[model samples]
Target: MAKRCVPVTVRWSDMDAFGHVNNVQVLRLLEEVRVHAFEDLRDHGGPSLLESGVVVARHEVEYLAPLVWRLAPVPTDIWITAVGGASFEVGYEIYDAVDGAAGGGGGGPAAGGERTVYVRAATTCVAYDLATGAARRLSATEREVLESWTDEPVPFRRRSR
Candidate 1:
């Protein structure tokens, strides 16, 4: 599936005492991406991931490096990792804004510049019926729409800190 790359605004309140984005703020960024990606579904009268009945079942975030505050927006790339009967997983990669282009940093850091990965994260969300208060199976169209954004499988494993 095609990945969605978005330029996210970094507000002053998003930073911590160290001038880097706070850990919680990073999750908020991911949430923003999720909402954006699912907007189409809601627009078409389908279940809304944010306003409708979708719920975050789990979130796994791996912080690779701190992202410093910059006037330019941070580039975040998001894709669907998996789609199930009633739930789906979204994957995200937040890249350091080097070269001033969307995900433009190439190779590794050079002597004069550095390109780094700020965060790698994933979220699992389940669809639910608001009135019934129970999980709802994904409609055919819903599944198809989500599958269109699916990427290669991501292994879920822990690494030593």
Candidate 2:
């Protein structure tokens, strides 16, 4: 997949006492990336589903390694892994940029290289009518926005869980 690069800075406060980013910080980082995605959609004159009461119904992340505290400029890649009728999933990978300065490596920095993180994850979220508390479908524009990010054919829907 051709992943979209989202270069971001790490806040000093994002780290925990261990001098590495806390596990919980992954959720926050993921959420930020998702929100940034909405901005991309909007810039393309696409619809954003964030305000439509689409909440995370599922989240699955595999913590690969610890991220020691750093000054700033972390590179995080984000992409639409899948888009469903009332839900969608996004994939993320947080990488340290130092190892990438010489410029070349996929996902994280070179194995065991400094300035790289190895954590990655995927999350699924669905839209619902806040007033009715029922599933709501995505708009055509939103669907287009999702498809713009990947070569994967759109996924078929299943009964809501």
lDDT of each: 0.79, 0.71
Query: Model 2, residue 109: what's the lDDT?
Result: 38
CA lDDT, candidate 2, residue 56: 83
Q: Root-mean-square deviation of each candidate, in angstroms?
A: 4.3, 6.2
lDDT of 1 at 7: 74
Task: Name the regions of candidate 2 deviating beyond 4 angstroms.
Answer: 101-117, 151-161
lDDT of 2 by residue, 1-161 (tens): 65777766567888888888788886787788778876877777876666666788877776767766566556777888888888888777777556453244566635555655556777787877889999889877777778778544223233235
Q: Which RMSD does model 2 reach against the true structure?
A: 6.2
Q: Which residues of candidate 1, in runs, are more than 4 Å off?
A: 41-47, 101-115, 154-161
Clashes of each: 0, 0
TM for candidate 2 is 0.77
